[model samples]
Target chain A: MDKETQPPAASSHPRHHAVPPYLLAAMAACDGAWEAPESMREIISSQPTLDKADGPVSVTRTRIATRARQTMLLDQALLHERSTAHQKLTWLIEPTGRLNRIISDAQGVEITPGTLIRSEGQKPSADIDVNRAYDGLGHVYGFLADLFKRNSLDGSGLVLRGTVHYGEHYDNAFWDGTQMVMGDGDGEIFNSFTSSLSVIAHELGHGLLQYTTNLQYQGQSGALNESIADVFGALVEQFVAGDDAAHASWLIGKGLFTKAVTGVALRSMIEPGTAYNDSILGKDPQPATMAEYVKTTEDNGGVHLNSGIPNRAFALFAKALGGNAWETAGSLWFNVIATRTLPENADFATFAEQTLLQARRDHGAGSAVESALKQAWDTVGVVPRLKENDDE
Target chain B: MSESLRIRVVRSGGVAGISRRGILELPAQEPSGQQDPDWFTMAHQALNQLRSIQEPATAPAVRDAFTWSLNIDGEDHVVPDQLLVGPARTLAEHVITLRGSR
Candidate 1:
């Protein structure tokens, strides 16, 4: 029939053998009643030449023989075996080289990967939220793979899955263990969750942290988890914008607010507690240093609030480097995480020490990187303090 | 005197990491035997259910999900967003929608 009426092609399926588009169409036209495998039929119909004139009688005879030969290798079991072999080899050699993104729609419900709306290599969806989620995942994946040599969120080519339009008036995005969930926001205070790339990267950051250091999600460790997420969020935004440390705005979730809200973003890395001062939303309560650390039982011991301390510290460190934050400071922090020796319940000081250690390992013991890291932690008032259990 | 049930829901976490406080008081147990409002009835049932479950000692493993600190009357129960369900979820939603706190 027509291209619009044709079933969407599964062109990216690894098992689909490479056949020239025009040839596949010509073969399909000449086949008449020749039955092909289900997957092969899908591939043949997707070719543009099917709508054109059928090939000559001589060409049809050749096409039937060629198709019969290829059909032997196209058996379900044989195809599966070949694909598995390819997968194993790809996993070992270059896991992070390809993108495997899947974006879905939740239809304003709290379900994940709700309805498959988009997949990797597909054209943009009609919905902006779906397209944004798709593009945002690509951006974050590219940032990690290009800068950090990471293989997706799990560092092993884990499929980047996401759901958009999650929950009614949902004003947040999150990583629910396996996939990313984006919300449409209440629209009064915040706009669509996918509107900001930093926000998307921040959620993906949680996934990265889970696969890496897995810092406990409470108190200081939890705050560090949030801070690192914010750091990566800011870094991804800066990397995409080509903004160096000094030139970056360092705002997380920037442009997420509607005009009615009296705020710029969710949090400010450079100047904590100043992201918003809305009468309805209240002032942002982030602390720029340890002295202002908020001790509370709510929000998992104020993980979000206290994270500002480390967030500010990172921003300071990156600014001190005065260049690509992702290059030096970001690399050092990621290196510390990749080591996987940091305690799950590591306090800020413990994390700071790990970073210092990593910095020394990467840049010499007395290098400027080490000094800048030390100064950043010092500026944030994070001194190495033993945990209560450690004191024992 | 008309009996009133109070609900204080503090929703925190999420990508924004903002904490929102929504406090509400609704008439309950009408002396005239009139039925209580849906919120009051739901709150009563939710409080009982919430009290029955043991409070989680550790933070929720899910990242960026909201944590809800719910106080009914003077009693306190903190429930992570993932665990909040049934009547408690509805009651909390109602309170937040009604108050829209700062």
Candidate 2:
């Protein structure tokens, strides 16, 4: 036969092997409803025995093995589908809910949510760390809600989750994208992470930024992220104590260090580099003004170091207003974020401009709030550009 | 077969945001008479592990997490604290704690 006119080979036809209806149903459910044969038997036995007179029940050994194998395959397929669907669901869910909080214990290992020790509305546990985490989360949630009208970090009632006692002598606390992880500290140099309220609030602030501008954590933008978190930390401490800006300590991690260390706290917002000076820790390298803006690649371009510039500016602005920092200053900053005009890689100058615009909108043109904000940015040597640029 | 090995470790970014550095110089191959220190084996193992798993090109910044920069011999490897594990972790801890134990 001519090649052009030749009939198609039988093997070349697309195969349409039929999938079992039961498997299709199981896959559609994808909820692990199909258990192992042994488990199914147990569940069956738990129910009333079907009529015993139904005949000899010819369940041959070979037949049972084949059924068990089929069940195993279905179970595996269901499990895989369940896992995939779970990932998709997690991505789709907006994480909206009430003020829900979950605290777990890592038990001195590098794991998170290791053991669920406490949940919302549960009684306090014997472990003080768990209680502290629970209470701290509550305080932070209250601060955000009462002051900024923010439901939670995401402004959508996202559940606040924390893991305490994360690692042996971990000596640190961090936000690991999904939740907060706190360490017990090495004791020689530092104390328990939960000992400071600012630390807890600061971690949550990162989550807030994640849901907000989602700022790029590098160089100037990274410094803004750290600075905003510190701002939230200080504000929460002040709000809880009912202390005004003047009375507030403006310290980020006070009482976080052991007596063996000479540091009063991790970072001082009002006076950035003055927070610590020790033989072991050296000296805090944060610069309080743009004149001293550090330029480096380490620490995400010295995020913690250069945040001092903005930190001091905020402290100055609050103190200049001379009342509850959370009232005008806090509201001003929160409004800037709520506006959502900030780009992911917004620079210091860009943020300073937004604060100016926000101040003008809230307090009117050339108001005292705007004046203080301008002076604050000027003191830090960050001059907002005359023309507003697109931050999209 | 004796060779000298020098390693420098610079640790930055914790809750404190303090930067610390330490350097260690020890014989790489076992010396003729004296036995190698514990860090000697750890250093070799860390380098081997680094070779096995090359440092990731990009790592998401964890809040208040430490970042370590290691200078072994003359080459440099910057590893985030979250990724520092096994022998590499032990060696980094030892260097930071002892601050050049010889």
Chain B TM, per prediction: 0.78, 0.77
Which CAPRI tier for candidate 2?
A: acceptable
Q: What are the models' TM-scores?
A: 0.78, 0.77
For model 1, give the RMSD to the true fold: 16.9
Residue-level lDDT tens digits of model 1 in A209-313: 888778888999999999999998999999999999999999999999999989999999999999999988889999999999999998889999999999999
Kindly list the per-residue Cα lDDT of model 2 for residues A92-134, writing each as its tens digit.
1112356889999999999987999999999999998899899
Model 2 stretches astray by more than 4 angstroms: A1-96, A388-392, B28-38, B52-61
lDDT per model vs. reference:
0.77, 0.75
Per-candidate DockQ vs. reference: 0.58, 0.47
Cα RMSD of all models vs. native, in order, equals 16.9, 18.0
Pairs of residues clashing in candidate 2: none
Model 1 chain B poorest ten-residue lDDT run: B28-37
